[model samples]
Target: MGRVVAIANQKGGVGKTTTAVNLGASLAVAEQRVLLIDLDPQGNASTGVGCAPGSVVRSSYQVLLGEVAVEDAVLETELPHLHVIPSTPDLAAAERELFGDEDWATRFRDAIASIRMQYDFILVDCPPSLGTLTINALTAADLVVVPLQCEYYALEGLSQLTNTIERVRNGLNPGLTIHGVVLTMFDPRNNLANDVAAEVRRHFHVYETVIPRNIRLAEAPSHGKPVILYDAASRGSYQYLNLAREILDALPIQAA
Candidate 1:
């Protein structure tokens, strides 16, 4: 069975999609079969991996609506072992339609379950809200990885996210747990960033790898390429590779 990890955080601009794209690519480069499920309607992850949302025929929306199978919705990326279930703007409406269904929270769980055995890892890129889509991602995931910005208000709403995870674990997915928290867009010159990192480390299982404020990381997405492929020597690329290795090392033996 594949290890399903949800790259989630209710906070936007925290590098959630960036982490999903790069980590999936990094794992694929390491010879692990990776399936990236883009749950966010923005479809940034889909674009980051070279899948144009507007051009995709079958997307997460169709899969969630039961119009297509997960395998049929999967799209090949530029990377050899990396595949993605692209999302479209239509997915934004899934939040409203899903609430009317009895198994709204488990829709994703069931959709992904049948395809779990095909890949070594599956990464879900969640939206920046605690809505039905995010709930679906959390319920489907075995582990959750939160990308936290190194800012003074970084801890704000974190309790709410954790509480939601607890509720999901208790009511929807009993095996759900936090994998680890990764600090993103870090700056060594900022004292506030250092302080926030220390505070997070004291309270949570924070990853040692910190993603620096790199221009290359910001630029790669626009080109529809991961930082590793855009510029492998960049700091952003190195940090994400470190994060991928750390994540692999931290996984359960079965998953590793």
Candidate 2:
């Protein structure tokens, strides 16, 4: 069975989608079959992997709405072992479309079930909100990887997200638990960054790999590539690859 990992944080610009894209690509490069689900309306995960969200005719919107099978919506990426279920701006309306439905929270879980065995890992890039879409992603995921930026306000709203995750675990998916928290956009020159990272570590199971603030990390998405492919020797590429190894080692299941 595949481990369905949701890369989420209600805080925006915290490297959630970046982790999803790069980690997924790095896992593929490590010879693991990976599937990235762009559950965010912005579809940055899709674009980061070279799939244009605007040009996608069939995306996560259709899959979430039950208009199409997930297999039909999955697109192969440039990486041989990586694939993606792209998302569109139309996904912004998913909450309204799913309102009042008794099974709304389980829609995504059901969509991902049939194809669960095909990949070693399925990473979902959730929208930056504790809305219905995020609930669905939480309900579907086996583990949640939170990308937290190392900054003064980094801990803000973390309680609310944890509360939401607790609710999901209690009422929807009992198997859901936080896999680890990744500290992103770190600047060692700033004492505040180190302080924030230490604080996060005291509270959560923090990943050992700290992602540095790098120009290549920010520039890779625009070029429709991961940092590794864009600039293999860059700090961003090295850190994300280290992150992938850390995640793989931490997994309870043996790699497929």
* Residue range 1-256, candidate 1, lDDT tens digits: 8899999999899999999999899888888899999999999999999986579999998998888999999989888999999999999999888778999898998988899999999999999999999999999999999999987668886778999999999999999989899888888899999898888888789998888889999999999998889999999988888888898887756742
Against the correct fold, how does model 2 do in TM-score? Answer: 0.97
Using all chains and alpha carbons, the TM-scores for the candidates as numbered come to 0.97, 0.97
Best by lDDT: 2
| Model 1 steric clash total | 0
**What do the candidate models score in CA lDDT, each in turn?**
0.91, 0.91
Model 2 worst lDDT run, 10 consecutive residues: 247-256
lDDT for model 2, on a 0 to 1 scale?
A: 0.91
Q: Per-residue error at 26 for model 1, in Å?
A: 0.8
